[model samples]
Target: MDLQLQGKVAIVTGASKGIGFYTALQLVKEGAHVTICARGEKYLEVAAASIKQQTGADVLAVPADVTKEQDCQAVIEKTIAHYGKLDILVNNAGTAAAHPFEQVATALWQTDLDVKLFGAIHCAKYAIPHMKQAGGGSIVNITAVLAKTPPASSLPTTVSRAAGLALTKAMSNDLGAYNIRVNAVCIGLIRSDQIEKCWQAQAPQLSWEEYSEQVGQSIPLGRIGSTEEAANVITFLVSDAASYVTGTTVNIDGGAGSAL
Candidate 1:
């Protein structure tokens, strides 16, 4: 299906690897000019090159820590300078910092909020004006199902993600008049760098497929989701194909979470 994204300009944060990388690649595949940013310059450039090679599209690599307001502004400014205008923004930079409430330190909580919550806010704060100026645009926040169905010991990640869901709704209401759509996707058990790290740390003897199968037993889908699966939803949400979608959350959890 045509996403109607050709010639659109987009920014996907934390695109160095994992879900963010695949989201940027998918946007490029849909014919959007994408600017991908991450804290690591080396990995960000590599991701950009890969997208260019795959889609033959112009990809911009920006090195920025979304936790920093200045860095977020820089990303928006650079994208505008390079692309002339903005059409989509995917606030995908985040860290999975979950721990028992009693064991979680104040500093860890602050750091988690800084990266996951404020990061999205900063990016959206900067992107909204440009989106308004360009007449209309779409913003997709990459959240987690834990936001709605918090499990035991899922501390700051769930809290921050819940805040993101709220942000998505609030922004959609405020920006609807400008034709800027705001929405979010709640991810669950997706194959990503963090999930791979868990496999390496907990069950090194098991092959990746074996580890994923064991992990997926509890999920209704009977398997872990791929990055592409997550990205496909995100690309659609940010495209004209979903022109009327806003102020909502799509759960990409394979029936793993209880929340609707």
Candidate 2:
């Protein structure tokens, strides 16, 4: 199953750990030169080093907060400067923060929108032009299943992710003529560093493995997803294999999402 991604250039946001890290690694595995960005410089560098060691592919670690427009622009600029082209942009920088609607503050909503919605916008804005110049490219937004199947206490994240899904469709429509494919992956209960942190903070007695197992039992697939599982789909979306896939949202959620 060659994805035909060899020699392509890609930039993945929030790549220090979790799904983003695995996506970047998978891109490298498919022979793409990858630039991975995150807010923490130390972790980003370490991630890059680890990916390089594992795949023996070129990896660039760029420390940039995607919430800032300038940082998003810098990510594209640096990738182009080094790789001379941009073929894939993975807008994967975000976190799931939920609060009761009545308890949600304006600041909280703004913060969520900044990272999930505007973060994708800024990265796509910068990447689109280069992609057009290079003839074509792919953009994969990492959203959540809650965007389609909203649940209680998922205030700001739900709203912002729904907006991200809309962005994926809009970008796909507008950029289709330029051969740039825009798509999104809506996640459910996936194993990641953020989830681990939450479990540690909320239930100190339960190890992540135990916590994940408990949650997985409720899902239709009888297990939670892995970072590699999500990454595999993303790599395909960004590759020549998914040449006709655009303006679509794929649910990577072990049948967790209620909406089709």
Identify the leading candidate in terms of TM-score: 1
Give Cα-based local distance difference scores for all models. Answer: 0.93, 0.91
lDDT of 2 by residue, 83-120 (tens): 89999999999977898899999999999999999999
After best superposition, candidate 1 residue 154: deviation in angstroms? 0.8
How high is each candidate's TM-score? 0.96, 0.95
Show the lowest summed lDDT stretch of 10 residues, model 1: 49-58
Alpha carbon lDDT of residue 11, candidate 2?
A: 94
